[model samples]
Structures are given as structure tokens and as C-alpha cells.
Target: MPEAGEVAARVAERLGTMRGAPVSVESARQLPAGASRATYAATLVDAAGVPEPIIIRAVPAAEDDGGLGAEAEVLRAAADAGVPVPEILDVGLGDDSVLGFPYLAMNFIGGESIPRRILRDDTYAAARGRFVEQCGGILARVHRIDATQTPGLDELVDPVEALHALFPREFDAMPAGLVLATQWLVANPPPSSPGSCVVHGDFRLGNLLVDADGVAAVLDWELVHIGDPVEDLGWLCAKAWRFGGATPVAGMGERASLLDAYAEVAGWRPTEEALRWWELYATVKWGLICAVQANRHLDGIERSVELAAIGRRSAEQEFDALLDLGVVSPEVVPDPLGVEATVPDEEPHGSPSSFELLDALAGFLRSDSVTAEMSPQVRFHTRVAGNVVDVVRRQVLLGATHAAESAQRLAALGVADQRALCDALRSGELDGTDEKVRAAIAADVRARLLVANPKYFAVPHP
Candidate 1:
């Protein structure tokens, strides 16, 4: 694989060769780092002309990110269907040549992400409302796109099936509790929708580009699938994406307005029950997705505080889902996984493991060197390392208690064992056929979270 430097060199060479003049790299900036992909800000200038800035996104070849070509196809299809997006200049499916990573380049939409920064402002709040309106209008247009034209559209898995297929693999390497939760979710598939549209698997604020007026570009199509449109709305309104947590609505606008705008475009309103159901499902789905990344960190695919910090947010999401389901009253939601039963005040037996030692070392490095002399990026990584230690320590302290409770709860439901319970949960063996089983699983999960992190239970009030 080409290193970032090697890739940059290739980018410079490619621009120079294309423009027929020597091109200099004016600037290159890596955007907010994440586990799934890397993004870069690139500006190039040729001797014959002016500078042009472009955004470059690179993903691992193995990911093949079913979303890539599918997303490009969706954007193209949406454009024809009348939704707005950035002009795609080019997309590259890597072959160990070009850049050693599957890459896509698009004209950098000139705007900040449509987020609270705009939603909180008096001048921008009105625009924010319009922005949500635009999102609904745009999504309705996206839904109108002919799925047959989008590659892999027919292969798109329904929400339940997709979750069943991906969750085990995603959380396979994580703690047993996550695996258990994944099983329970798969087992309890909701009422399936006959309406399959080109769904933006990740339609949320952070993925959008916005100017002072409205959405300039809808970004991140990696998870785009031909599934239920309500999935998009649910995902958008999901709590995790509601950064700062004040926006009761998706991306900080009212959900009703967003839905009403969609009705305006589509000629029919999506049922509130359907939307709410999808929203609850999306919450668990996203939380499970985050759990996978947390596992990656635990497994050493990457050590990052941001990823571990994000792992903590999953409990918060579970609380939101519980509230949405009406299984728990908003004011009475319990503490996470009985955290009081976990998180110890003393060290464990025997010699500290390498992770623990590295954690200690990272802390020392943070205080003595990182905080004092390192660049922001280096400091950020140091904090990530520290956070990883925190997450691991917390899990080690709390996990066994939750796992034991989970096993007991599953057994009480007549599940022979954890694996059997997981299999039953994934195979639809416990849907309408097993209401008591589902209730038991939900109760156990709630109790586990209460024991794990209670502060997360309090949903942010507007």
C-alpha cells in the first residue's frame, strides 16, 4: 500500500500530467480521522493556471465499500431524480497503482457541515429549518431514483437481514455482551416494509455540507442501500448523530417539518409508527456498528481515544432507544450497566498486562511530553491512547457482571445457553413467536446498561 506521502506524490504527478504543466502541492490536510476511511483536503496549482482545491477520500481496497459505486450511482441517479449534490469529478477503484487505495475526488463543496453551529444561530436557524426542508425534499427525490439503475441495488439487504448479516461479524470480536445484544436485535426483527427505495444508509448532519442558506452537498454514501426510505429518516434522527444532543429532531430541525416536507414531495406522509419503529431500530443498529469499531480498537486494528470515546456513546444510544420504545419512562431511565458494581478503586491481581503498562506510559507521556511539546495531532493520539486504557479498564471491571446477568436472563427465558440465545435472536425464532423472550432480553440489556453507565440514561431535553 502506498503511504500518505506516496499517495500525495502520485496526486501531484497525476495533476501535473493531466494539466500538462508542473503542479505544486499547495496544501494537504487530513480531516477528522475515523476508523472506516481517511479524508484529505488537497489544493494543486499548475504553472499554466490557478489553484484548484479538491477533496480526496480513500478507503481500504478490502472494504470495496459496497457504498462507493452504489453511492456514486445514487448521486447520479438522485441528480436525474432532482436532488442536489457536489459535482463528481472522478472516482477511482484502486488497483495497487493510482494511490493504493480506492479513492474518490469531488469538487470541495464550499461550506461547513450543516450542524449545530448553524442551527444555534438566529440568522442561521431559519436557514436550518429550510435546510431540513431541503433534506426531506432531496431525500424524496432520491427515493424516486430508479433502483434498477444503481449497481448492487437488488443486492441490498432489508434492515433486519442486513443487521443479521453484519452484526455478528461486526461484534464477533467484541465483548460477549455486545454479541448478546446483536443476537437479541437480529432475533427481534420489526414489521418489514414493502417499500424499498434507494436508502441513504447514513443520512445525518455530519455527512452533509451546508452553506449559510442550505445543504450544498450530501456526503458519505458508503452505506447507501436500496432499502426502506424511513431507514434514512430514522438514521438521521438517531441520537448519536445529534451532536450536543439538544436537537430533538434530525440535524436540529423539527422531525414533523422534515416529514411534512417529504410528504410535500412524495404526495404521502410516512406513518409516524413506521418512522418511530425504524428510528428505534436504527439506534440499535448504529450502536452495534459503533461497538464493532470499539472492538477494532480492542483487537488492535487501531488504538484511538476517539473510537473508544465513541464506544461510550453506544450506551447513551441504548437509553434513547429504550425511551423511544416506551419500555422505560423518560424520567425514570436507569443507570448504565450498574456502573457502581463495576469501576473499581484498586488495581487487579498479578503483574500489569502490557496494555495496562502502555496505558500508564501513555499517561506519563501525556503529562511530561505530549501536553507540553507535541503538535495537536500527536497530542490527540496520546489522548486516544489514554481513552483506550480507560475504556478497556472500565469494560474489564464491568463486563463480567453484565455477562453473568445476561446469561441468567437468557436462561430464565429457557435459552439453553448464550450461543443458543444468540442464534435464536438472529434467526427470527423469537419474533411474534416469542414475546416473552424478547422482553427478557430487553430487560437484561437495560439492567446491564444501568449497571454500566446511568448518566447516559438522561436524554438531552430541549
Candidate 2:
């Protein structure tokens, strides 16, 4: 994370270049919960003494590239195409005389990005009704942006091949339900579409800024690419983006309504088969992404409680994949806890038990850190830390038994470990539909959720 002083200095320097005079940064602060890049909202006074509110999107110094320039170009193209997007002001700064990292500045638009607020808040009820159709229309316009018009965005490839490359080493070792879905995807590839277009690689509810008027602007263009357009549509409907709402289209609009809106604008609707294929792919892709986020924390690249907590969410995606694949029924099974095992209290003279210490830490984070007046980033991470501790507490209570049961099931299926089983399944050596294989995979997924997040199972699945 860049220091507030550094970010302010960089923004001021960049503003000077654009305004042809020295600029003063009045305030700069990091936004909360940015997963990939550091985002800052700043107020600047130009040479003319005109105050401007801008958002600075920058990558860490160690990972800086000229990608911001390309992103600015994409944003311009999107605006020209009639898509709702933030206005790009400047790009490609971070020289020795300016900011220390490559960054893009854009005019910040006021709106809400939280899914729950957009979906449930009475103030946004009218916006919610129009969201699916509006999003569909916006996406159609985005896809119509000719690839040739934008430079440096020609890097396009098969979506399936792209997904295959995202499997991290950790995923291979654990072989969660994603292994089964990936195998099926490889065997049953979707019919290739004939052309490519600009895709909002991360189009979904949270990425959209909304108000009473509906979506004001689409944000997060870091993953923008030229690919199958349906990729965006499918990602929009992914269960991970739903935020606990039952509606499939971003937890607000029905799938059919979204498709109908898209068809009216794009002149064609994606087939049911095509949508299902991509939706399943989205699930697997999110699972792999969760694994990668976790690995970043584990490997010490960027230690964050948020990243660690997201790692546990990979199992939720895996469970969703199983439901989509029909390998597991959508019907909820009874909780794995048949009878609670008694956890012994600390010995008379022993140190505090592991659970006791973890519970205390979790309570402090929840009760103190959250209510403490702090920066949004600090408060968000504090809550995430509390959640992490709670997950660890569950693991402490249930992990050993879950592991023992998983090991026994794997042995009965003639696999020495999860890695071997994944290899067999991926290689088509094992019957994916075999009762034993499905049972073992389902059982493992359930046990994982029981620790990682039990609320996931409580949500109705279709």
C-alpha cells in the first residue's frame, strides 16, 4: 500500500502536468477493500484554484507497468460507445519527478457499489428493477467497440484456455470441487463463437455504481479484454457475485429478463446451453481466483486478513460448481455435526487453550476495532481479521474430524490423496459420475464449508 503522503504528492504532480501549473492536493485517502490495486480518493486544487475530486488507480511500485495507459484508452473507447463509465483525466505518471508508481486518474462519480445496498435498500428499489436491463444494454454497447480502434488491447485468447492457465499449485494439491468442474469443461467444451469483442472482464453488481437513477458508471477495467461477450453475461450472473440474494442476475434481475434486454440491444440472445456453460466456467474461474488470493497471503507477497478470508471462500465456489454439474443435489443436507464432541478446557496449570485465545481476539476485533474511529481501510481489515479468527475457531473445533472422514473416504475410493484423485479425474481415468467419487467430493466440499462458511449452505441453491 502506498502512503497517503506519497499518493497525494503523486496526484498533485500529475494534476500540475494536466493543468499546466502547480496543484495542491487537499486530501488523499485509501479506499477500503480493493482486492487487486490500491485506490485513493483525493481532492485537488489546480493552478486556477478550482477544486476537483478525482480517483487515482495505481498498481504497487514493484508491479508497475504501463497498463494504466491502456486502461485509459479503453475507458475513452467505452465512453464513446455510450457505456456509462468514469471520465479519464490522465494516465501513465509516476516518473522520478512525480508519483512513484504508474497510475490513472479519473473523475470520481458519486454512487453506491455495495451489492446489499443496491439490492435491498428502499431508496434503490426503482434502480434495482431497471438494473438487469440497463446492464444488458450497457454491455451490448461495450461489445460493439471495434477492437481495431483500441491499441494494446489486441491480446485476446480462448476463455477456456485462459481458465486452464489460472489453476494454482495449491488448488492442484487440495483438488476441491473445482477439479470435477474443470474436467467436465475440458471434455465438454462450448462450441466456439466466430468472433471476438471487448468484454468487461469483471462485469458484476459490485463493479457497478448505482443510485436512484440506476447504474451511474461501471468501474474496475483492469481485466478488460477482447473475448467472447457472453463471458461478461455469465460473470454477471455468477453465484459468488449474488451477495445472498436468490435472483440469478446479480441477485436482482432474472436470467431471462437480462437475456431479453441483451437480445434487444445486441440483435441476438445467448443460447441457454451457452449461458450455462459460461456460468459454470465463471464458478470455476472464481474458485481459482480465490485460491490465488489466498496463496498471495500464504506466500507473503501481501499479507492481508481480507485475502486470507477470501481463500476460504474458494470452497463455496467449488460447492456451487458441484450443484451446477449435478454431481451434488441442490437440496441441503443436515449439518455434518451429528453430536458435538466435548472440547476439554485448559488444564489447571496450563496456558490458555487455542480456542480461548482465538475467541478473545475475535471478540476484540469485532467489538473494539470495528467501533473504533479509524480509516475505512483499517476498519474493513479489522472486520476481516475478526472473520478470519472465527473461521480458525471453527477449524480448531471441526478440522481434525473432517480431515479424518475425508481421508477415509478417499482411501475407499482407491485414491491415496486428493492430488491423485484430481489427477485421475482430470485425466478421465476415473468415472466422474461414479457414486463413490461423487460422494467423496461432496462430503469434502460440505466439510470445508462447515468450517470456511456455514452460511453458504443456508442459502437456497437452484
lDDT of each: 0.65, 0.80
Question: What TM-score do all the candidates reach, one by one?
Answer: 0.77, 0.93
CA error at residue 432 for candidate 2, angstroms: 1.3
lDDT (Cα, tens digit) per residue for candidate 2, span 1-462: 878667877767866876789989888888889876788888888777888888888877346564676677788989989998999877765464256667777898999998888888998999988999998899899899867767667444756567655454754654558877877777787766546889878899888899998999999887888888888988998999889888788888788888889989999887767777888999988888887888888989888788888999988988899888887665544442333555545577466778768878888888854567877788888888887887888887787788889899988878888788888887767788787788899999988888887778767554
* Model number with the top lDDT: 2
For candidate 2, the 10 contiguous residues with the lowest summed lDDT are: 330-339
Candidate 2 wrongly placed segments (more than 4 Å): 61-66, 93-97, 154-156, 166-174, 191-194, 330-341, 344-351
Poorest lDDT segment (10 consecutive residues) of candidate 1: 334-343
- Which candidate comes out best when scored by TM-score? 2
